[model samples]
Structures are given as C-alpha cells and as structure tokens.
Target: MTEIRHYKIGEDRFKISEDEVARRELKVTKVADDVIQIQEEIHGIIALVGATSTVNIKKDELKELIKIVREEFGWTDIC
Candidate 1:
C-alpha cells in the first residue's frame, strides 16, 4: 500500500494529494497572464488536455468555481 499526503499551494488555488504528485497525475501552476493551469495525467503516462482560467477571481467568482468543482469533482466543502 502506498501512503499519500496532501499539499496545497497558493492561498486558494489548489489542494493536491501526495499520490497525485508522486505519480505526476496532477499539476497546477500560475502563468504570467494571471491564470492557473490545471492538468491531469492518465494511464500512467498519458497527459490529458488541461484547462486554464483566470486566477484573479473575486469572491463571487471563487464561490462559483468552488461550486462547479465540487459538483464535478467532489471537492471538499469550501463554503
């Protein structure tokens, strides 16, 4: 069995798991355009097409994003 830990970056941008990092399954980085890129890897080596969105989100936008991610990905309750 593999032990997994969690890592968080930025103030409110990400919540990553140790398994994800060790396997390179996820990546989130802030680009110079004030946007964040969210990536996921599949099948051990295949890289899925990722999404990039503005990171300069206000309170309302943050709430919306949290809601969407929660509904789609089952993220932890942020509200």
Candidate 2:
C-alpha cells in the first residue's frame, strides 16, 4: 500500500502531491434528472470518476455537508 502524506499549506488550503505534475479539477454534473455524477480531471484527462448520488439532498444532510466544507476551508460561517 502507498502511504499518502498530508501537508498543511499556509492558512486555509493544502496540497496533495503524488510526485506527479497534474492540475486536477473536480467536475460535478447532473447526469440524469435525479442522478448527479462527479469526476476528477487533469489537463482534460479523467483521473478518477467520483460517486453518483441523488439530487435530493435533504436538509440535515446538507447541513452536514456545509459543516464539512466550512471546517475544511477554515470558514466558521458564511457571510
């Protein structure tokens, strides 16, 4: 198994490196009326295909998601 290391960059962001020069961007799209798909791409190359979930994101679930983003980005609250 490969051991992944985490580095804390300046204030609110970090970089994940794998000894490769790649600029990855996450793409989230509504593949179907109710199905959502996510993917990771680097220079137009699809690196990973993310999970597909229902578009019906509940209130509680959304709150938890918001909390996760806020904590990770060092955002205590949104203005």
Candidate 3:
C-alpha cells in the first residue's frame, strides 16, 4: 500500500509519499531574512531528481506564497 502525508516543522512545510514505484517529497522552508526555500525530489530507477529553489522575497510575496501553499495543502494555518 502507498501512503502519503503532509506535515509541518517549525517554519517549514512538507509533503511526502512512499509507494511501490517511487518516493516523492516536497518541502518549503522560510530561511534567514527575506528568503524562502522550496525543494522537490523523486527517488526511483531514473536516478533521483532533486531540485531546489530559493527566493528572496518581500512580505507581500511571502504572504502570497503562504496563501497558495495553504490552499493547495488544505491547511488553515501555516508558519
């Protein structure tokens, strides 16, 4: 059986899944001043594809990102 879950740690959010074919993960973290980091990865026969991006964002940009993530993940609150 495959299982998928979403959770949060500190100022970060995560979604992880493990199944027969692959393991997939996504994470968002607020790092330092005006910076946020986003990462995604998939582990499988194709040699794990891991990618990461960092954005130096203003308060409004951060708020927009948070709102989008919260809506996508069905969360009422996030840090």
Looking at candidate 3, the ten consecutive residues that score lowest on lDDT are 5-14
**Residue range 1-79, candidate 3, lDDT tens digits:** 4233333322322244353465444445544334445644445545433594443444654676687566654456577
**Strongest candidate by TM-score:** 3
When superposed on Cα atoms, how far off is each prediction in RMSD?
14.3, 14.7, 12.2
lDDT for 10 (candidate 1): 20
Candidate 3 positional error at 40, Å: 0.5
What is candidate 1's lDDT per residue for 1-79, written digit by digit as tens? 4333222222332324554422323334333233445444333333445586333434654565555455544555556
Across 1-79, the per-residue lDDT of candidate 2 in tens digits comes to 5342222221112244654344544434434434434344344333545796333344554564455445543445543
In lDDT terms, which candidate is top? 3
Task: State the displacement of the C-alpha of residue 14, model 1, in Å, after optimal TM-score superposition.
Answer: 28
- Model 3 residue pairs with clashes: none
Q: Distance from true position, residue 16, model 2, in Å?
A: 9.6
In terms of lDDT, model 1 sits at 0.41
Among residues 3 or more apart in sequence or in different chains, the pairs in candidate 2 whose N, CA or C atoms overlap within 3 Å are: none
Instruction: Quote the lDDT for 11 in model 1.
Output: 36
